[model samples]
Target: MTVALWCILIAIFLPYLCTGVAKVSGGYRLKDNHDPRGFLDSLEGLGKRANAAQLNSFEVTPAFAAAVIVAHLAGNAELVTINVLSVLFITSRLLYIIFYLADLATLRSLMWFVGMGLIVSFFVVSV
Candidate 1:
């Protein structure tokens, strides 16, 4: 599969990674599984930011995946271009999560914008 396709898979699972961080850091217990959302809602600081990042990850993943898929199907853009944008999007998301956990709101927002721009670039390149 293409690198951009692999990135779609990564995007799908990225939220789980963030949630794992929140759960592990927030003192997750087996019993908490019964109320996972509540457990996450109770988290603070790093845990809270991680949970928020997870949610944002979920929110953006569909668009990113769609952009990659559409770009591939459209066959209008160079494979290397699509792959580079996909990699950059994933990198931006990783940095976004880091910035969020570190409470760097400005940097986190900047990363968010960069990821979104990468998503849009996929579509623009396809056309």
Candidate 2:
């Protein structure tokens, strides 16, 4: 398999990774029953970020897959570059989720932009 395929696989597993993080953190139980709201809120926050990462992965993976197939079909020499970008994009998105869950808005947004830029670049190059 190509690097792009590996990156896609990693992206596919990102949501599971987020869930693992949540389980390790608290297993969905917040605190006392009196403060159930707080626990639920924290879980909600993590779930939102995990959903965001999954959405990003969904957005980029298809394009990366297409690029990989097309590159192989057309004998394009830039497949490695595209695959590298795919890896970088997924890695940045994983970090983005962690930072987002930690409430690091600026850094998360920056990482988001980087990931989106990679997707856009892939689309542009593929066309």
Candidate 3:
């Protein structure tokens, strides 16, 4: 499969990664109550950050999916271009999560910008 498509797969899985982090950070257990919202609300520090990362991932996923679909439909964007931009976005997102969990606000912001730029690039390249 194309890397861009793989990116979609990665995007789908990213939220689960965040959830896993949140669970561990918040001391969640299998038998615990499933009041996720409550649990997250009570979280602080890394736990809070993990929940935020999950939320952010969900927020950005639609735009990223739309951009990739547009690029596919345009049929003009080069495969290498699509792959590189896809990798860039996913890499940035991974960095975003790491930076956020580590409380590196500046780095997280930078990765956010980079990921957004790559999303925009998909549209621009399609044009």
Each model's TM-score? 0.98, 0.66, 0.96
**What order do candidates take by lDDT, descending?**
1, 3, 2
lDDT per residue, candidate 3, 9-104, as tens digits? 899889889988998999997766767778878898899999999999999988898898889889989989988898889999999999999999
Model number with the top lDDT: 1
> How close is each model in CA RMSD to the real structure?
0.7, 5.2, 1.0
Clashing pairs in 2: none
Name the TM-score of candidate 1: 0.98
Candidate 2 residues lying further than 4 Å off, grouped into runs, are 28-77
Model 3 alpha-carbon miss at residue 47, Å:
0.4
Q: After superposition, how far is residue 53 of candidate 2 from its true place, in Å?
A: 4.7
Q: What value of lDDT does candidate 3 attain over all alpha carbons?
A: 0.91
C-alpha lDDT values of all predictions: 0.96, 0.67, 0.91
The residue-level lDDT of candidate 1 at 39 comes to 97
Better of 1 and 3 by TM-score: 1
Consecutive 10-residue window with the lowest summed lDDT within model 2: 23-32
